[model samples]
Target: MFKYAKRLQYPINIKKKDINMAKQLITQYGGIYYKKDIKK
Candidate 1:
């Protein structure tokens, strides 16, 4: 669904809890941080 949404925008205004969860996942996977609409 999200992958197909070409017009999506970001800085997304995500909740603090969601941001924390995302940080955890990124750390676990050794991934770099980026905005939702930006490709790594």
Candidate 2:
């Protein structure tokens, strides 16, 4: 187990039809949030 932020529903559920696209989008979103959090 590990710690997590309060809102844990950012990376929305995705279908298997476009896994690659979903992954890229999630990565971008996650990277932005990650950097933002580090500054806090």
Candidate 3:
């Protein structure tokens, strides 16, 4: 469990890979993070 984080976690090695896939993963993870942030 996490209390708080200073940075947003993005996919590993995404910088050298496909931008599209990176975006998809970011959005998916970001949504969950966003919801949790609001709940807090």
Candidate 4:
């Protein structure tokens, strides 16, 4: 089953990895926001 995270899950090792790629991945996981003022 799927679960929600209340805090930091684990320590990620990004040594010698591309910073930009990491940022993009994190942003993508942030999901989408729905606003009442926004139109579909």
Instruction: Tell me the whole-model lDDT of each prediction, alpha carbons only.
Output: 0.59, 0.61, 0.60, 0.58
Name the 10 consecutive residues with the lowest summed lDDT in model 1.
Answer: 31-40
The alpha-carbon root-mean-square deviation between model 4 and the true structure, to one decimal in Å, is 9.0
RMSD of 3: 9.0
Best by TM-score: 3
Stretches > 4 Å off in candidate 2: 1-16, 32-40
Model 1 bad stretches (over 4 Å): 1-17, 31-40
Model 3 is weakest, by summed lDDT over 10 consecutive residues, at 31-40
Query: After best superposition, candidate 4 residue 37: deviation in angstroms?
Result: 27
| CA lDDT, candidate 3, residue 6 | 75
TM-score for each candidate, following the candidate numbering: 0.34, 0.35, 0.36, 0.35
Best candidate, lDDT: 2
Q: Report how far residue 11 has shifted in candidate 3, in Å.
A: 14
Residue-wise C-alpha lDDT for candidate 3, range 5-36, written one tens digit per residue: 57757654434767567556766878656444
Instruction: List, residue by residue over 1-40, the lDDT tens digit for candidate 1.
Output: 3566566565566555666676677666665544453354
Show model 3 residue runs off by greater than 4 Å. Answer: 1-16, 32-40
Per-candidate clashes, comma-separated: 0, 0, 0, 0
lDDT of 1: 0.59
Tens digit per residue, CA lDDT, model 2, 1-40? 9997787656666455775675567668786454444332
Whole-model alpha-carbon lDDT for candidate 3: 0.60
Pitting candidate 3 against candidate 4, the one with the higher lDDT is 3
All-Cα superposition RMSD per candidate: 9.0, 9.4, 9.0, 9.0
